[model samples]
Target: EPEVTQTPSHQVTQMGQEVILRCVPISNHLYFYWYRQILGQKVEFLVSFYNNEISEKSEIFDDQFSVERPDGSNFTLKIRSTKLEDSAMYFCASSEALETQYFGPGTRLLVL
Candidate 1:
């Protein structure tokens, strides 16, 4: 079974900056999602995309956050202005059905 993969396994950034995290989900999956875990907190859902549009998103996914499927294999999440609280391990997940999602290793974003 293919798994989702993310780039730049670790990232360090200054506050109020912009960051774009990348992911390559399993080829056959149709739904994609983004989730984040602050240093010691539980995983929190950010957004979900399907068919090139956002299907569902959490309140945490405010105006500063965006998701894109720029190509067939690449899915991206962009944070327009990073806040100190935005420092977290961002995960990418994909699923053929809504029930089970396979997660990537995650991109660790550190904001100063």
Candidate 2:
């Protein structure tokens, strides 16, 4: 399957600001997910969406974060308020089922 892809490979923002990360998951995949890896920490799952609704999400995905499928091919992750800790590499992924996922190159966000 073709891998997922994210736009604006890098982003720089100020604390308390908002950022919307865009993604295009594999066309045929039914499940899409967002994850982030801090500079030195393990990759952490943020949220997963299917059939236009969120199927699951981690605690880290609080009110500050949201996911949406605005169209047939575009999926988006919006961070309502940025924080220094929000700096990380955000990855978009897609899977045929709940199994193996194909990850994108990632968008590196730097909150200053």
Candidate 3:
């Protein structure tokens, strides 16, 4: 079975720095999304991308965050400027039909 894979799995960043987490979604999917969960918080939607432009974004998606599909199977999320509160597990999801979203293990981001 195909799987969504994320790099680093965990990252340590300093406040006010930049970090880019990478993901590779399963093949043949069209829509990709980014969600985050703070240590004990609920999963929150950050943004969704389809056709290379953002399809929908939540209020939590501020100027500091951006996403891209750099290749056929690779999706990336960039935190332009990080903050301590930005620490969370960033999950990458993809769905072929928008009804079943598959999630990766996630990239745990820790900002000091």
lDDT of each: 0.96, 0.96, 0.93
Is 1 or 3 the stronger prediction by lDDT? 1
- Tens-digit lDDT track for model 3 on 26-86? 8988889999999888999999999999999999999999999987889999999999999
**TM-score against truth, every candidate:** 0.98, 0.97, 0.97
Single out the weakest 10-residue window by summed lDDT for candidate 3: 65-74
User: Model 2 Cα displacement at 80 (Å)?
Assistant: 0.5
**TM-score, structure 1 vs. true:** 0.98
Can you write out model 2's per-residue Cα lDDT over 16-72, one digit (the tens) per residue?
Answer: 999999999999999999999999899999999999999999999999999999999
The sequence of per-residue lDDT tens digits that candidate 1 reaches over residues 1-112 is 6899999799899888999999999999999999999888999999999999999999999999999999999999999999998989999999998889999999999999
Show where candidate 1 strays beyond 4 Å.
none
